[model samples]
Target: MKKFKVSLLQLDVKFGDPEANYSNVEKYIEEAVQDKPDVLVLPEMWNTGYDLERLETIADKDGQRTKTLLTRLAKHFAVNIVGGSVATKEDGKFYNTSYIFDRKGQLISQYQKVHLFGLMSEDDFISAGSTLNQFIIDGIKAAGVICYDIRFPEWERKLMSTGQQILFVSAQWPTKRIEQWKMLLCARAIENQSFVVAVNRVGNAPKDSFNGHSLVIDPLGKILEEGATDVEGIFTCEFDLDDLKAVRGNIPVFDDRRTDLYF
Candidate 1:
C-alpha cells in the first residue's frame, strides 16, 4: 500500500535504567497501538540514555533482550517496528545499534550507528558501524539511521539513491540544538525528495536536556506532525509513500547528479 501511517514514541529515557525503560516502552507501545499505525518508531538509546561510562554493565548483551522484546511486540501487535538504537555489547566491544522488525516479528535490519558523536563522548565508548541499514517494510523500501548520522548529507544521499521512499531516524537530540534538528530533518526531506520520520527523546540526562520535537516531514519539506518540547507522548502522522515519485520527477535531482566529479 502506498498510504501508510507511522507512530513515534517521543519518550523520556531513564538514565542507566534498562528495566524501567523496558516497562516504559511496553506502556508506550500499548498506548501507541491504539492508533493502529503501520509502523511504530522509538527514540535512540531508549534502553539506556547516554549512560556511557556504565555501558559495560548495562548494555544489552548482543542485543538479546532488545531483540526478544521487539520481536514479541511486533508479532503480537502485527505492526512493523523500528526498535531504536540501544547500547549493545558484542564480543567485548560496545556499539550503538538499531533493530527493525517486520509484522511477523522477523528481524529485517540491524544497524550500528556509523558516525559516533565525539561531543557526547560516544567515540570513546562505542565502536562506529561500518554498514548501512536498508530494508523493506510492508512492501515499501526504507532506511534507518541513528542521531548523529543525520548531520551527514552524503550518507543520507547514498541511502536515498537506492530508491528508498522513507527515511526513519531515531535520536536523543539535545534541546540546545533543537532548532538544528528541525532544520536538518526538513533539509533532508527537501534534498532527497523522501519522507523523513524522526523521533527525538524528551526530558533530561545528567549532561543534556532533550526537547522532544519529534517530526514527520513530507518530501516537499512540509512538517506533517511535531511533538512538544520536553513533553513525553506519542505522535502519529500519515502520508502517501508514492508521493516521492512525483516530487523526484519534478526536480529530477537524483537523475542530474554528476557522479564523475564528486569522490
Candidate 2:
C-alpha cells in the first residue's frame, strides 16, 4: 500500500473565547490545506478552550455548526478531517465531542469524550460518551480518542483488536505533565504497533499552560514529526502502510497475546 501524508495543526487557543479561537483555527486549517495532506488533524477544544463554566451558553447545539464548517472545508479541499474536540450540546446536557469528515464532505464518525477529566471538573459540565470511535478512511481502519483517553490502554487495545492501524489523539494536555504525555503516546504506538498521531494545543489557559508537543509516531515508536512548545504551527508526516505491516509481522505481539487466559 502507498503511504499517506498527514498534517497536524498545533494551534494556540485563546482561553474561554470561542470566536477568537475559531477564527485562529480557521486560518491554520486554511494554511494546512496548502500542503494537500491526505488527513488534517486539529487539537482538542478548538471551538472553545476550557470554557466549561459557560458551556450551557456556548456549546455547539447538536454540533451542527462545527459539522457544517468542517464538512464544507473537507469538501472544498478534497481531504479527510479529524476535527478536534468541541463543547457540543445535545439534549439538555453538554459533551466534549469530535467530528470526522470524509473527502466528499460526508460526516463519517462522531465521538464524545468517554473519559472525563475530573481534575478540571469536566464531568461536572459534560456528559461522557458511551461508544468507541472507529472508522475507515481511504480503506484504512482508524480510531480516535480525546485528551485523557490515552491514559486507558484497554480502549486502544479494543480498537487494535478491531484492526485499526492508525490512532488519532486530540488533546489539551497541561504543560506540567508534558513528560507523561510524551511517554504515554510513545508507549501506545510501540505496544499497539500502529501509527499514533497526537495534536495538542499551545499557549496558556486561564488556570493552566499547554506546551504543544504535537507529534506523529510510527509503528516502531519512532517520532516522525513534532511541533515546538511555544509556537503555533502545522507539522506533516508521511506514513507507510507497508512499514506498519512489516513491523507487525516481524513482532507478532498481537497474534501471540493470551487473551483467553487474561480474564
- Number of backbone collisions per candidate: 0, 0
Tens digits of lDDT, candidate 1, 1-263:
37899999999999999999999998999899999999999999999999999998999999999999999999999999999889999999999999999999999999999999999999999999999899999888899899999999999999888788899999999999999999999999999899999999998899999999999999999999998778899999989887877788889988898989872
lDDT of each residue in 1-263, candidate 2, tens digit only: 67899999999988778788778877888899898899999999888888899888888899998888899889998999999889989999899999999999999999999999998889988899998899999998999999999999988888777678899999999999999999999999999999999999999877899989998998888899988887789999887888887898899888888989861
lDDT of 1 at 242: 73
Candidate 1, run of 10 with poorest lDDT = 254-263
lDDT of 2 at 252: 86
Alpha carbon lDDT of each predicted model: 0.94, 0.90
TM-scores of all predicted structures: 0.98, 0.97
Candidate that scores best on TM-score: 1
